[model samples]
Target: MRKLVIAISMLAFAGSAAFADPILDRQALMKERGKIVGGLAKVAKGEDPFDAAAVLTQLQALQANAEKLDVDALFPAGSDAGDTTAGPKIWEDMAGFKATEDKYLADVKAATAAAPGDVDALKGQINTLGGDCGTCHQTYRVKKG
Candidate 1:
């Protein structure tokens, strides 16, 4: 039983170490950010109207990229993911951190899907998505020097 527990713990640690490089995670995040923001900007401006085609394309790409960046793995619980500007508050306030990512993805997906049908309504949803971002930034992110 003890050996089994140790094996499982070791596997979990190895997985975290394999995936938890903040530099790479940050880079992955930046790519997703660019796609999601640019995608939604097209919607906010009402640039595409009924089509929303470009926004949809970018949004889909954003979602795909987002799936690769896990909020749970944002912290190096045991292994080092490097010195993140993320701060210890994120790890300590784990529920808050997870909720931010959860809402971001959900809001973006729902809003993007509806954009093609009702541009105005979708715009409102998009604003909510942006608001989620503001909330997360307020909690988790530090202002750039």
Candidate 2:
């Protein structure tokens, strides 16, 4: 009886650990993206001086992350239950979710290629890039308080 209980406890712990790893990874990825956006926001708002080289580097990093982010793998089944801000609609309408992801990736790629030469050029691209971010968050993510 004691052995049975121990085994069950171990199995439950293992299951939860497996579930948690992906959630943690996804959270870290989101935070990294958020930091990149925050930097760009500072430049956009004139809180920070616009350095074209720095902005281009950040945009490249953003593009790299976007390219490597596999939405389906990051968001496995049952991931929406825990510490996640993802909405149920992501699993329900996976096609739409993927479409949104793809659009964001495309936008990032375009922005990276454009590589805005100055603050004004960067500002011009901000609307499109920010819109992509906002659209996905609005449609797919749950608001956290």
Candidate 3:
């Protein structure tokens, strides 16, 4: 399932006209993150549910795309992508933003070992990952845009 989602993410990024509604896209990404990370936690509980292998496999893939992903594309500079709700501080504060993402990937990599039977510990790590998501959203996304 994680692999399928990653494949979709990839296809969405690659397609030239794949412009998802900004607000809806943001919600979808946040929800998807919750589901995938939560799925890892369930595996840690020894529930034998959700394909942990797929999650593990896509962690690196997601991170790779994430590293290159410009959330600001939701608010492109010179192109005709139209006005986005993302703030200009995203570019002004890019270093911090990339660090946030790097730390997210790092956390996911460390937490991956908890898979198949380490859900509890992974759950703890999962919340920390949410911190990154929350921080960026708070800084970059407009609440009602």
Best by lDDT: 2
Each model's lDDT: 0.67, 0.84, 0.58
Which scores higher on TM-score, 1 or 3? 1
* Ordered list by TM-score, greatest first: 2, 1, 3
lDDT of 2 by residue, 1-145 (tens): 9999999999688546542466787787778898998898789889999888999999999997777567777888888898889899989998898998899899889989999888888887778878888988998899999
Q: What is candidate 1's CA lDDT for residue 139?
A: 86
The sequence of per-residue lDDT tens digits that candidate 1 reaches over residues 13-101 is 85566455655666557566866676666767767554556666766776665555676564556422344456566777888888788
Off by over 4 Å in 3: 1-55, 58-61, 68-76, 79-83, 113-116
lDDT of 3 by residue, 1-145 (tens): 9999999989877566433555445445555666665555455465655465665664544454344444565434432234444555666777776677667767666655554334455456656666777787788655553
User: Model 3 — TM-score against the truth?
Assistant: 0.54
Residue 134's lDDT within candidate 3 is: 79
> For model 3, where is the 10-residue window of minimal lDDT?
74-83
Cα-based RMSD of candidate 3:
6.1
TM-score list, all predictions: 0.68, 0.83, 0.54
